[model samples]
Target: MRHIILFFIWLGIGQISYAQEVRYETVENISYVDETASAYAKEQCKLDIHYPTSGENNPVVIWFHGGGLTGGKKEIPDFLKEKGLVVVGVGYRFSPNVKVEDIIHDAAKATSFVMKNARKYRGDVDNIFISGHSAGGYLALMITLNKTYLEAEGLDADELAGIIPFSAQTITHFTARKEQGIDEKQPTIDELAPLFWVRKDAPPIILFTGDRELELLGRYEENAYLKRMLSIVGHEKHKLVEFQGYDHGMVYPGLPILVKEINRLVKEKE
Candidate 1:
């Protein structure tokens, strides 16, 4: 009976360790992604890596939060924790600390860091998905269309597995144009805008937006136009889903659908 007791104790330990499957890695004070920042004093950023313990080559998602790029933590929504996938919630410097362009640069660097080290976590380097809410969605779209940022990190944007945004602005983000003294009412889509990056070769894009009438600031219409433009460019792997009853503020309640879409998109790519 003593041997039996010890066996059960060992089994319990194994179960406990298994339950801690979502491993985490943090990069504190990430002032810069370049070698120079390693020796400079600057604000830090971190990544909370969550993963399922049982998959051989799991898909990884980098989720950017939305607080108008002024505030928001590097957080994975609680619902995201048990999805049987890998999730990395990002934190970047806000608007006043840096220009809107700098925020895009930070996102690119964070993605590069993850791709460069993907093997360490049993994640597929090719299956990285960029996703976010509101301002975060706008950031995700910019990264997908304006490939320069990822190119700086030596990764091609076309090589990304998918582009998914929840209620992301498709027109010029007001915050960015505001930085240039441009009027938000007279918004323009320039090279910095995601709509400007539409091409036939873009990764499979699955866009989700809230109901048109209930959305904030013409969010649904912008996505509709973006979808049309991508279609005009002959992008066949694109989809736009309008959640019938959901509104701009429903991303928390709407992410599972995004996750399912992620699953579908990756499977198609595979």
Candidate 2:
């Protein structure tokens, strides 16, 4: 009788272990750039996808890297792994070699590709979230608020599940202004600024920034104004969070918050 009880207990433990396992796979360098685009773009415009092998209709987070629009490589942080989600790290052409406008276009093309192929990876197009640090965050806001960029590639920006930009610029990116020899200290909100396209009807947005005193170049204040304007304009789903002890490099602490937001938003949708 005791042996029989032990056998059943072992079986239950094995079942539990199997149920908790999350099998995943990684696919690298899947090009989303057009054939007509320049060779440099084709070389740089690629994405790396890491997804769970199980679970249908899973959520996907598309991550952009921060390098002030002139540098930075696509990277999937380890903090986001093994969470029953798909994370895509995107690579795009850099500045000086390519203008910031071209980079935004590349990001749009990559997002369109992800939306169209989500199902192949067992992901939901409606549950796709866009996120990134610094310049990458700027890309997320630009492609989302402007809409025209995604529309050019036959995808609607409004279809995104959420936008979570970490320490991003709401004004015209300083890099863009630098092209015209404008100083970084002098801010501008022009056609390229995400502030230029704030609307009430857009998808849910979460702006994450570091402590105001520690963040670089007023990043936290910029995002605060963005949240305020979004609210003033009637956007109900927008949220802004400031990490107390973190600085411009807030992605580490922000990753867990992202997961929480993902689960919260995705569950509400379900």
What stretches of model 2 exceed 4 Å from their correct place?
1-12, 19-21
Q: Using TM-score as the measure, which candidate wins?
A: 2
Task: Assess candidate 2 and give its lDDT.
Answer: 0.94
lDDT of 2 by residue, 53-143 (tens): 8888889999999999999899998998778888999999998998899999999999999999999988888899999999999999999
Off by over 4 Å in 1: 1-35, 38-44
- For model 1 the TM-score comes to 0.85
Total colliding residue pairs, candidate 2:
0
TM-score of 2: 0.95
Instruction: Compute each candidate's TM-score over C-alphas.
Output: 0.85, 0.95
Writing each residue's lDDT as its tens digit, candidate 1 over 1-270 gives: 999999999999999998786654433333335556532113445566776556657888888888887888777777777676678787777877778888888888888877777667667888888888988888888888888889988989887889888899788788888887898777688866788887888888888888888998788988999999999989988888888888898786678887888789778776
lDDT per prediction?
Answer: 0.80, 0.94
